[model samples]
Target: MTRTLVDPHSVPAELRPYLQELVHRTHSVCGPHLVSVIAVGSVALGDYRHGRSDTDVTVVVDGALPGRALPGLATALAHPALPCPAAGLELVVYDEDFAARPSGAAGYLLDLNSGPSLPGKVSLDPAQSSAFWYVIDRSVAHQAGRVLYGSPAREVIAEPARADVLAALRASVREHSTGAGHLADNRVLNGCRSVQFCRTGRWQAKRRAAQAVAASEERFRPLVNAALRSYERPSRTAAAALPTADVRAFLAWVAERVDETAV
Candidate 1:
């Protein structure tokens, strides 16, 4: 059996009202079909910065959710209506069976990306898979996701293969290198995260991973520091932009380390 989150205080003080509203509205819309609500990413990881990190939530519903529940849930949780307190809300809905068992591929009923600056994507099709990021996020959720409203994550979430997860991390580094993904904070910090995962097979906090890289990898310290400093800021201004060449080289270095250390 898996353990649920033991301490209510584990969830930070400042975000409680938003979380309360989240749970209330979610229960209102999802009703009995909703099985679990797990908080992944920064909130679960204990390094959330209100203005910087989004409310990352994964909802599990009983398998075979009715058609009506989809849009109802979307509207209920979409920003402005629910009023996300963080940078935004990264929310995904999965059925109980899908979330509770191990699988080789990625799937979801809905991926609602909403915020003031977000894409406002209400992804409903299981056919459209963003496996690179999705798989990695799911893997992290399995290991670190804290229970908000359901069984413990260890009982409800499946464990993905280490190799598959690392492959996605490598793909992410490559994607940024090619300019397909270009957020400076994500690119630089994700590079640190990728290398850290390859070494430990654990998705620790990005800032912590960057700090680890800085301490051990002398050659990359300055670049890693720049990434860390930029990541801590409230917003990404032009001054926060990391050197393109250094970013590329750091990602290249991360790729090589991933190849070497991946289990």
Candidate 2:
């Protein structure tokens, strides 16, 4: 069940062929019920950290497939190189209704912001938008990384949401000042930690080692700052939470931050 992690480049070189084969194989068995198979996660984003990453894939099947046939596909994904044994493979079958409003579409939260897909491409959905936003708000603000898939693979996800993303990004930078035990505990901090950890094992380890420096005082300060910062002036970059009044308020708050920083 344990497979060695493939670097982003190697993943596509190795996994893509297998995935294409899997798609064809699924088509043969399930008939024309299969739609597309997409790859998500670090591999999709291109900013994959070599060793500490796993391939996240989405198998888009046609609605015609019977419920019973799915377990078989799950069983099929488990190989030495692509070890999606049992629970590892998350098979999501989309009906025509769901397909149109894919929550994991190219512009969805994380995927919109990720790098390039190593092997295959995945779609996104908008209903699950909140979760994606939550992850980005916490992760990007705190970490350093890139997207590998969806959108224009070469175009960075950072551009669309730069101002707000930077706001969170700046917050994460400040989070590192305090001793936050693990990056995941803080969204953006975790993203930053993941990027650092992926690149040089020792570098993140070194960064983690310094976590004890500011400890409680630093941690409390950042959290308080984020709360106060986001309170009066919440971000408008959140597509779900934007309106004319909210946008105006958010912009005013952003201006205040710039003014204060300039002073």
Candidate 3:
């Protein structure tokens, strides 16, 4: 049986109030520093898992942000009153590095359309193409997160439908499973299979993989393990490589823990 997990509210007493405060703090300090604020992830979707989720917020400055604001920003996040005590925060200062990327922000780029005046903006166009799609593809591929804060993330970008998710997955699979004798990266491969494909070519592949996932979890586990392990390796070239031994061993350990509570 799948183990029961605690509800998010039960796990974090101050989370809601903290987030509210964050909205205020951001608007204030960011007046000069930020032209826009975009909230992303499950939090924005309103389906955040208490202990499992971290806040994914994008603060877009007028120009590039100076180094001075980092501390103030950190304080706003780690303020003792909030839920979960700011375990971590991803502050993506969108500038040239972001602008040059193929798949901007992440793989599943949820653009925010918060409306005029507060016409919030954080562009994901920078990431519409490259390896970054792997991240975006996975988020939307899962259940739709609740809209905890901010407007609809889907409206800002040119998603054109669900084609973006399919495209990202296709790119991910090709990168991880390319070439003969190459060990296919399983974790990512599984993700590619998990998401629905909007395009005709990818739709067929998605269907085939979906059938395979349903038929055999055991067969898929190894691939998942391999990809998860190798996902963080330093990229030397474009080749699909296996993960380090430490990664493999760590995954094995996790498997043991999961099996321990098996129904």
Q: Cα lDDT of all candidates, in order? A: 0.78, 0.35, 0.39
lDDT of 3 at 96: 27
Off by over 4 Å in 3: 1-14, 64-67, 79-88, 95-194, 197-263
- Give me the runs in candidate 2 sitting further than 4 Å from their true place: 1-11, 79-91, 102-263
- Give the C-alpha miss distance for residue 62 in model 3, angstroms: 2.0
Error of 3 at 225 (Å): 16
Weakest 10 consecutive residues of candidate 1 by summed lDDT: 1-10
Cα lDDT tens digits, model 2, 1-263, are 10112223534454555445545555555555554444444434443333233345444444567756654554444443344321123223334333333132223211222112223212245454333333232232123222222212112212223334334333434443342432222332233333333233212322242242224235333432332233223222211222333323333333344334333
Per-residue lDDT over 1-263 for candidate 1, one digit per residue giving the tens place of the 0 to 100 score: 11233345768777777776777777777777767788888888778876777778888888767977888888989988888778788898888888776665557889888986566878788667657767777888898988777776778778777777777877888887875536776787788888888878788888898899899999989988987887778853322777888888988988898778664
By summed lDDT, the worst window of 10 consecutive residues in model 3 runs over 1-10
lDDT of 3 by residue, 1-263 (tens): 11111123522353555555665665555555444344445454443434333455554444456655554555554424233333334434333233223332353222322211122333345354354443453243123322223332232222323444444444554443333323334334334343323212232232244345434556445555545344333331222555545334433433332233231
Q: What is the TM-score of each candidate against the true structure?
A: 0.92, 0.37, 0.41
TM-score of 1: 0.92
The lDDT leader among the candidates is 1
Candidates 1 and 3: which is better by TM-score?
1
